[model samples]
Target: MTRITMREAISQAMWEEMERDPDVFILGEEVGVWGGSYAVTKGFYDHFGEKRVRDTPISESTIVGAAIGSALTGLRPIAEIMTINFAFSAMDHIVNQAAKLHYMFGGQLILPLVIRTVGGGGRQLGATHSQTPDAIFAHFPGLKVVAPGTPEDAKGLLKSAIRSNDPIFFIEHATLYQTRAEVPDGDYITPIGKSKVHREGRDVTIVTYSKMLETSSKAAEQLSGMGIEAEIIDLRTLRPLDMEPVLESFRKTNRAVIVEEGWRSYGVGAEVTARIYEEAFDYVDAPIQRVAQKEVPLPYNRTLEQLALPQVEDVVQAVKEVL
Candidate 1:
């Protein structure tokens, strides 16, 4: 086992996958010469050459369209959208074409395509660039949504998404690229659509993912000082969201606090809270609470931006309210 940053883990996953499968290639803005906007594809251009690590114009639609075309021709394409906010420009192609192609063709086609993008409200990227619209994409069928919190999951999940014969939208937190964690030093892949328990506790179930996972973990530690043991469940995948672990945890604690970097209304927390009540209502000891970004466009000012985004204290308070 070795400790590495999230960026390195993601880079290693793509590197290994491209090396393992010749069909796997990457295309996006600044992926080649700029080494990716977030530097996740650093050194890929030189290593894979222009034929494989082809860079395209600053057009999200063109990038996604090209990837879909190549995937239809039996090539595994990893399309990078630079940022999640820009994904809206290619929404038609992503949701209509890439997602429904295989089914529309009666399984005669396989879109082994992965759309990689970064998102989150930090680093002062302003309102337009820093948005976590993961739930919106997950709402559509035939599109797998994955957002990892740790380096290990990031590496493994990316590998699995590349191999799956389905369209996948992989979201990476912009602020978590520098976060470090211990990862397995091997050619292994983590299955998509599985939620894993990051910390075990019997007090209250704290469910979260992506950048919010880190925030929630910190809040859990703070809650410990007050004699509160919070069990953290990372919903690594959003679309095929696994509720077994979440339900099981809620069954034990009889309480839950769903945290997300996005807004609270109709967000991930809302969906999880609904599912828990629907399946595990009998185990409810208290009303579930939600922690999420404020209902406003993220500001450019650092102070205002942090104010709008969910914080550790917000999570702690939400947990207490639920408990």
Candidate 2:
């Protein structure tokens, strides 16, 4: 095993996939020459040549539309939307067209494309840029949503997204790119729609995904001091939520505390909580708790931003309340 940062892991996944398949190509603003907005795809253009690593204008709609068009024509396209805030401009191409293409065209066409974007609030990118819009894309059918929390999962899940036949919305938290972890040496794909239990416990289940996994893990450590063993489930794929593992964990710990950086109203936690209440109602020993952002635009102030977003202590307190 080799330790690598999430940015390096993501680059390796796309590089390996591009080298493995000729059909795989990348395009987006600042991707080819600028190495992507956050430098995630740095050095890709020089290595893959200009054709494979083409750059486009600063148009999210055009980039996603071209990818969708290329996908229908049997070319595997990987496009980046710069940020989650900018993706709203391409919702028509992303939701109305690419998402419905596979089923809308019967079983003839398989739209294999990936839209990579970044979102998180640590840098205080203001209210618009810091929005976690994964919940919106996950709401639409025929689209796979993936948000890996670590280097290992980032590498593995990116490879899988590149090879998947359906359209995939790949979200990378801005603050998690530099996080280091041990990744496998050879080719490996972390199966999407599968939840991984990061910790074992008998008290409460802390179901979370993406960057929130870090906050949840820290809370778990603090909760351990209080004799509370919080089981952490990273829902790496938000679309096809892997609730089986969650249900099994719920059987071990009859309470839950769902967490997200997005708003509490109709967020990812809301969907997962509904599933728990519907499928595992009898197994639940208490009202399902949630730790999420306050229902307001993320403020520019550092202190206010941190307060709006769910913190480690917030999760710990929520778990205590559930217990």
Candidate 3:
């Protein structure tokens, strides 16, 4: 085992996958010369050369379209959009084609493509650059959405996404690039649609992932000191969401609190809260509480940015309300 930052972990994951599979190649804006917007692929250009690590123009639609075509032809293409917000420009390709092609063709073809993008606030990158859309891609069927919280999870999950013969949206937290953790060496991969019990508790279950997982874990620690044990279930994958663990946790605790970094309405929290109520309503001792961002355009101001987003205190309060 070795300690590394999330940025290094991500870079290593893609590098190793490309080295392991000759068909795997990456293309995106600034991925080559600029080393990626967040430096996630800094050395990839020189190491893999321009052929494998191709850089495209600043067109999200073109990047995604090219990836779809590349995938159909047998090349495993990992398309990187600089930010999640810009993915809208490529919605046609992502939603209509890449997502529906396999089913549309009666399962005769495989679309082994991965879309990598960074999201979440805390960098003061303004509203356009730092938006959390973990739930956005989940709305569409056939797209595998995942957001990794720790450096280790990032490495493992990315490796799995690249190998899967399906279209995947791998979302990364913009603020988590520097966070460090120990990642095991050698061959390893995290399952695509499994949620882990990050911190087991008895009083309440806190469901969260990605950047919010950090906040939820901190809130769980604070709750523990107050005589309330909050179990943290990290929903690493948003779409094809695994609810078995969530139902089990709610059945044990008899209370639930969902923590998400996106908007409160129609967000990941809303979906999870509804599922818990549907499957585990009889086990609930209290109503499910949610900790999420305020409903408004995310402000660019540093103070306002923090105000609009979910905080550790918010998670603590939500947990208390549910308990």
TM-score of each: 0.99, 0.98, 0.98
User: In candidate 2, which residue ranges exceed 4 Å CA deviation?
Assistant: none
What's the ranking of the predictions by lDDT, best on top?
1, 2, 3
For candidate 1, what is the TM-score? 0.99
Task: Choose 1 or 3, whichever is better by lDDT.
Answer: 1
Work out candidate 2's RMSD over C-alphas. Answer: 0.9
Model 2: how far is 89 from its true place, Å?
0.5
- Each prediction's whole-model lDDT (CA): 0.94, 0.91, 0.91
Instruction: Please write out the lDDT profile of model 3 over residues 156-219, one tens digit for every residue.
Output: 9999999999999999998899999999998799999999999998889999999999999898
Which stretches of candidate 3 lie above 4 Å from their native place? none
Q: Which of the two candidates, 1 or 2, achieves a greater lDDT against the reference?
A: 1
Poorest lDDT segment (10 consecutive residues) of candidate 3: 121-130
Model 2 lDDT tens row, 237-323: 998888999889988898999999888888898999999999888888999998999988988999998989899999999998999
- Each candidate's clash count: 0, 0, 0
